[model samples]
Target chain A: EPEVTQTPSHQVTQMGQEVILRCVPISNHLYFYWYRQILGQKVEFLVSFYNNEISEKSEIFDDQFSVERPDGSNFTLKIRSTKLEDSAMYFCASSSILAGVGEQYFGPGTRLTVT
Target chain B: GESVGLHLPTLSVQEGDNSIINCAYSNSASDYFIWYKQESGKGPQFIIDIRSNMDKRQGQRVTVLLNKTVKHLSLQIAATQPGDSAVYFCAENDNQGGKLIFGQGTELSVKP
Candidate 1:
């Protein structure tokens, strides 16, 4: 089965540096999303992208966060300035269509560690 | 502002036994629910889902029961195996889009 794929399975960056997490969603998928989980915390939604634009976002997705679909296949989340709290497992997910009900397939996830 | 939460933090069951994990949602408007399984460092893996209109749905060795009246959901796994040891999470979708509110998660350990 086709699945979402993310690059840099694990990332380590300095506290004030900028970082980009990349994802290649399923070729035919139209909707893409980003979620994060702090160690020992529930997975939290960050933002959703469709038509190369943001559809919905959470408080955690503040000024430091931005998402881009620079190409037909790549969806990326960039943090302007990484913070210690930004250290978590970031996941990318995608769904094919909006049929009132469809499953969102998740990637293995990129573990972001900020020093 | 609504949140999805689990009742239990951990559950231990013997291999070949059944397991039940429960969840509660604060939003009555939420209509879609899903159950996901996550191993140590992996992402949440989809298990089964149930709509608010329906009371129950079954898939493979798992069954999902939704009680919209009380805003509750549960996952039942039959004949659990050692591989079933993982953290299970219940998620609720308000249906506005694809956003899902996930529960705290329940750690399930199937003993051999």
Candidate 2:
């Protein structure tokens, strides 16, 4: 089965440094999303992207965060300035219109460690 | 504010037993619900999903039950095995841009 895949399984960066997490969604997927989970907490929605634009974003997705679909398959999330509280597991997900709008397939996730 | 939450933080059962995990969502507008399993160090894997129009759905050895009146959801695993141990999470779609709101996970432990 085709699955979403992310690069740099583990990332370590210092505070105030910029970090970009990359994801290659399933080739045919039309909608993409990013979510994060702090240790021992529930996963929180960050943002959703479709048609090369942000469709929706949560309060946590503030000025520092941005998402781009630079290419057909590559979707990326960039943090302009990393904060210690940003340390968490960042997950990328995608869904095809045929798969139903709500059924999303998730990638293994990139563990972001902000020191 | 909208949120999904698991009723229990952890559950232990003997191998070959059945397991039922419960969740509650405050968002009445959520029309879609999904159950996911996360093994250690891995991402959440899709288990099964049910739409608001359907009260129950089954797949493989798992079944999902949704009660719209109570805004509750449950995932039941039949004849659980040791490999079924993981942190299970219930998520509801906010219906806005398909953003999913996930619940705190319930850790399932199967003892042989």
Candidate 3:
């Protein structure tokens, strides 16, 4: 089965530095999303993208964060300045609207570590 | 180190036994409910889902029951195996963006 794929299974960066996390959602899927989990905490929604614009976002997705579907298959999340609190596992997910009411598929995730 | 579910609940079952995980959702407007499994170092994997119009849905060796009146959802696994061990989460789908709001997870441990 085709699955969502993310790059750099793990990322480590210094506080105040910029970082970009990349994902390739399943082909032909129109909707994409980003979620995060703080260590052993519940998964939290960050942002959702569709039609090349953000449709919904959580409070955690502040101005420091931005998402772009730079190409047909690539979706990326960038942080202008990383904070220590930004250290968490970032997950990318996608689903097809054409399929009508199906579940989203998730990537393995990118573990972000800020020092 | 901080623990993810130090305060969360856990269920232990034998390999041949059945396991049932439950969740109490907070959204009444949410029409879509889903159950996901997350192992260590992995993202949430979709197991099964049900719509608000239905109360019961079943998959391969897995069944999901939803009580919209009480906003409760449960996942039942029959003849649980060692591979069934993981943290299980329930999520409600947003109306607009296909975003999911996840619930507190339950740890399931299957002993062989």
Candidate 4:
């Protein structure tokens, strides 16, 4: 089965530095999303991308966060300035359709550690 | 402001036994629900899903039951195995764009 893939399985960055997480969603997928989970907290939605634009975003996805589909296969999330609280497991998910019943497949996830 | 939550944070069962994980959702407008399994150091893997119009849906070794009236969802695993040990989460879709709201998740441990 085809699955979503992400690069840099783990990353360590200094506070105030910029970080970009990359993901290659399933080839045929049309919708992509980013979510994060604090060490012991529930997974939280960050942003959704479709048609090379942001479809939806949460409050946590503030000025520091931006998502771009630079190429046909690559989707990226960039944080302008990282903070200690930004350290978490960032996951990339994709779906072929936009229906509510459609199943979204998740990637292995990139663990971001800020110090 | 709606959320999905699991009743039990953890559940343990012997290998070959059946396991059931329960969840409660507060969003009455949610029309889609999914069950996902997550192993340590990995992202959630989709298991099964059910629509609000359907009461039950089954997969290879899993079954999902959705009670729209009470806003409850349950995942049943038959003949649980050691590989089934992981954190299971139930998510609900708002029927908008494919955005999903995930629950706190339940840690399932299968002992052989």
Model 3 TM-score relative to the real fold:
0.94
lDDT of each: 0.94, 0.92, 0.88, 0.94
The digit string of per-residue lDDT tens for model 2 on A1-115 reads: 8999998999999999999999999999899999998988888989988888998999999999999999888999999999999999999999985233448899999999999
Residue A90 Cα positional deviation in candidate 4, in Å, after optimal superposition: 0.2
Restricted to chain B, the TM-score per model reads: 0.98, 0.98, 0.90, 0.98
lDDT of 3 by residue, B11-90 (tens): 99999999999888766777888889999999999999998899999999999998888778899999999999999998
Could you give candidate 1's per-residue lDDT for residues B1-112 as a string of tens digits? 6999999999999999999999999998888899999999898999998888899999999999998888889999999999999999998888898898899999999999
Candidate 2 docking category? medium
Model 2, residue B73: displacement in angstroms? Answer: 0.5
Taking chain A of model 4 alone, its TM-score versus the true chain A equals: 0.98
Model with the higher DockQ, candidate 1 or 3: 1
Q: Which ranges of candidate 4 are over 4 A from the true structure?
A: none
Candidate 3: residue A14 lDDT (0-100): 100
User: All candidates' TM-scores?
Assistant: 0.98, 0.97, 0.94, 0.98
Q: What is the C-alpha RMSD of each candidate to the true structure, in Å?
A: 0.9, 1.2, 3.6, 0.8
- Model 3 chain A scores worst on lDDT over the 10 consecutive residues at A95-104
lDDT of 1 at B89: 96
Clashing pairs in 3: A40-B4
